[model samples]
Target: MRDVSTLVSKTDELTYKVPVGLKRVPWIETLLLSSEPSIRSIEDTVKLEKAFHDASLFAVKEGYRRLAALNVPAVRPGDFLAETLRDDRTMAKVKAKLADEAARIKAVEDRKRVQAEKKFAKKGANKQQKKKFQQTPEDDDLKNLKTLEQRKDGGYSGKAPKSKAPKSKAPQSKGGRGPGGPKGGKGTKRSDGGKGGVRKSLFKKTSGGGKSSRGKASGRRFKAFFLA
Candidate 1:
């Protein structure tokens, strides 16, 4: 009740005596050209020949059933297995059997190949899905650019997405000069010249060979230089 395909599949797993064809030519040719008879000369060649000849004679005297079972044609009772393989009708049968077996084996291999590809494809799809899920989202700037790419004119139209600017802190005051000045005062009085005053020069030639001296004993050196 098995289908033809199923039967053929089973045939691939079956063991059998492989039919010899042109593949046996080299072996037979070597045996024929050898200087001496092989070790099994009598057992293989002579014995098989005697058996086949006797079987032939027996078939002539009694029946064809035994000859039929031998699976050899009566036209030739070969002296050896190789000779039996060389027969034209026998070679044809061998070729047919080999072709059938080859087809079955090829079918099995094709099935394995298809199954392997399906498995590999499934694994690849899973890997791609996982990789897609693990990837991070694009930056807001890049996302905006991509949106521009999708527009009809293929250019950025409206204002680009703005980034938040850092807040400016008020500057600290030095020397109590500006709005950040000390809470207690109208600011310290400068020694060089009070508030808006200016000094004329610090290098007015002194009566002592123009040698420089401190103008006043003020704690502010920068102011004293200008005032002198």
Candidate 2:
């Protein structure tokens, strides 16, 4: 009699653990213990789905060992003779099952090959994109400086209008009151006769210039009178 108090472990898939005694038992005996009438699929019904179909495959795979050990010929329904003594119609069905397994293997291999090719193609396209980016006119050192400026000014896009106008021909003027400037000319012109306009009155006594007031009165003196 079965021990009704024994705790059985239930798997998440709804299959319970085979009892300790049942575990690793000959697959043929396991099938005999099952209550299923036959092993056939309406729509690819699984072992767990069809109630004891697992026992059938297990037994089918171990057909010779089970029957020889049983010492009885007609004890099991899915016998070695059941498949072997079949007509031409059954043979065709069995070969077709073999073909399905072959097709499934080939499909998996083809899918892997396609994925690998696509991955390598994408890598090559990435390299080409980087090369094209490096070759653009925007990659010039001076152009890049302008791009940096534009980015600092909050331009998210790198695009900028090109300046086609000719560069300025005139010299860049110096800042802060140039010497001999618009406001005052040098003293050289007044005394020593350098180019351009009259001297600044402030620097008129500079070297190599004509006489100042101190030199103008060199031979002159003033007379003084006194009374007793």
Candidate 3:
């Protein structure tokens, strides 16, 4: 095995040579001339990004100084003269994806709101129905009182009341020989005589052979009876 002490002594004795008067090279120029090295790890990618940022800062400072010395304009003539890293078509696709994501989020929110409203609305409807059908204590008491009062007054029976039979009136009698008198009374004789008399009167009044005279006689008799 190698001795640890000897290895340590050799490392301590080693010396690095430093070059003098070497040409200075800027990171911006080096990056512009060649493609960046492929990153192998996360740390390497972060270091590359930091280097690119530093190069951009250096370019901005150098470009301003160089353009001022050359008496040239530094700002572009138009905003569109500046180029973007991503093309217009790629940017358009990114915007479309963003819009789809926003729409989907909005639709989900609307659906949740509608469901919550429906849930609350059903509870409200059920509450209203319960209130409508529920009987109050005051109303129940009033109804009971009314029923008791009716029973006390003998006004209400459990079943419908039976209808009473109409009373039959006795035939009126003016005297002992009136309409309701003896069966063989003078009133019967008078009635039998009046029928023949009424027929004879109608025939005698209609002897002119026109219906107008007969109708007039009947009308007059009815009018006299009504007045009496």
lDDT of each: 0.54, 0.54, 0.60
Count the clashes in each prediction: 1, 0, 0
**Cα lDDT, model 3, residue 196:** 23
User: CA RMSD for every model?
Assistant: 22.2, 21.7, 16.9
Q: Which 10-residue window of candidate 3 scores lowest in summed lDDT? A: 195-204
Mind sharing the TM-score for model 1? 0.27
Q: Which pairs clash (backbone N, Cα, C closer than 3 Å) in model 1? A: 202-228
What is the C-alpha local distance difference test score of candidate 2? 0.54
Order the numbered candidates by lDDT, best leading: 3, 1, 2
Could you give candidate 3's per-residue lDDT for residues 131-228 as a string of tens digits? 97897999889988888789789897775457798998644323224334563233323434442222233334455666566667778667544432
lDDT of 1 at 13: 72
lDDT of 2 by residue, 1-228 (tens): 665444342333455446686555564444454334565655653333334436556655566566667774645456655565557786577667767867998999999999999999999999999998878565687777977887788974956568699876433233222244453322122334333222122323548576657544432212101100
The TM-scores of all predictions, comma-separated, are 0.27, 0.29, 0.32
Better of 1 and 3 by lDDT: 3
Task: Give the runs in model 1 whose Cα sits over 4 Å from its true position.
Answer: 1-32, 35-92, 137-228
Q: Which candidate comes out best when scored by lDDT?
A: 3
